[model samples]
Structures are given as structure tokens and as C-alpha cells.
Target: MTHQRKQIGSGRNAIGDFAPKLAELTDDVLFEDVWNRPELSPRDRSLITVAALVAGGDSDQLRFHLKHAKDNGVTESELIEAITHLAFYAGWPKAMTGVATAKQVFTA
Candidate 1:
């Protein structure tokens, strides 16, 4: 089986067909194929992904990614700096929400 198919088979069962495909794309393709590239460290990738998710106001996704960001060596201060930088461009509200979520993740 292909890497995506293997991941799909091992993943949790979902109610819809598309959800599994989406998960495979995100897990195997995005995470494995792209994030695992040698050029960019996992820490940098996590920082970029988390910042994009936060700026996009994707709270649910951000919450999950925040933890991964920490695991990938994204420090609390770096996360805060990212949010602060986004505030000027992506809006303060989104940054505020991201900051709050980061706080929870840092404390956990």
C-alpha cells in the first residue's frame, strides 16, 4: 500500500468518506511529505503552520497544532512573538485568540 493508504487504514474511522482522504492528505502528505523535508526543520514547519492556522482564525486546528508546535521546539515566547507579529497584519482579534490558546497549551 501507498503511504497515504497505509496511514488511512491505521487512522480512526470517520463517518464520511472524504474525512479519511482529508486526514490522509494532511497526515501523510502535509506532515510526512512536506514537514519532514530536510531543508526546513520540524520546529520551523510547526511554527509556520501554527502561525498560519492562528492567523486564519482556525481555533480548533490551532489548539491541536499548538501542542505539536511545543513538541517540535516552538517555545512559548516564540509563539507569542508570532502572534504579536500577526496582530499588525492579520488583526488583533485573531492574535488575541491565538495568544489565549497558546496560554492554555503552555500551561498544560
Candidate 2:
């Protein structure tokens, strides 16, 4: 089955003016290579990425990944469970932020 690739960010439109190289790497290396790896499905990658973003308290990135996660077949229930599970290990504040970001993504 062909997996639909989710647009993770604004791509060149967001960074190309000031950081062309970074934009290129974000598009070519990160998304094209690492994310497109065949071993792990995009859904699995979305789970891991969202969890890591929550653990890092990186809500900026979390918003995009949360939407991408849903596009990749991750349900709202699963995202809720993941954030809830991470609260203890990653800290309550981070998980809470994740939940807030998730709510926005899900509702949007």
C-alpha cells in the first residue's frame, strides 16, 4: 500500500528566505530520508516523534506532528493515551502542553 506523506511544516516557505540550507536539509534529509525509511511505518514514526516532542516540551513542533500523526492513522484516543502515559516519565507540564496542542490539532 502507498502511504500518504503528510506535510510536516511550511517547508521552504517558512525558512527558505533566511535559511535555505536548513530548509533543504529539513526537506531532503529529515523528511525524505529518515522519515521515508521503509522499516518503520509513518504511523509508528509519528508516535515516536510525538512522544519525544512531548518529553522535550517542544510544543512548537508538537503541533505539526500531532496533525501529521492523525493523518498517518493515529487516532485521537491513541494520542490521548500516549500523552497521558508520558505525564509521569516526562513531567506533567510537558504532557499537559502536549494535550493542549493535541486538542488544537484534533479540533482544527
Which candidate tops lDDT?
Answer: 2
Q: Which parts of model 2 are misplaced by more than 4 Å?
A: 1-10
In candidate 2, what are the lDDT values of residues 34-65, reduced to their tens digit?
Answer: 88887888999999999999999999999888
What TM-score, to 2 decimals, does candidate 1 have? 0.78
Error of 1 at 31 (Å): 1.5
| Model 2 TM-score relative to the real fold | 0.89
**lDDT: worst 10-residue window of model 1:** 1-10
Q: Model-by-model lDDT, in order?
A: 0.75, 0.88
- Top of the candidates by TM-score: 2
For each candidate in turn, the TM-score is 0.78, 0.89
Alpha-carbon shift of residue 13 in model 2 (angstroms):
2.5
- Against the hidden true structure, what lDDT does model 2 obtain? 0.88
- RMSD each, Å: 5.7, 2.1
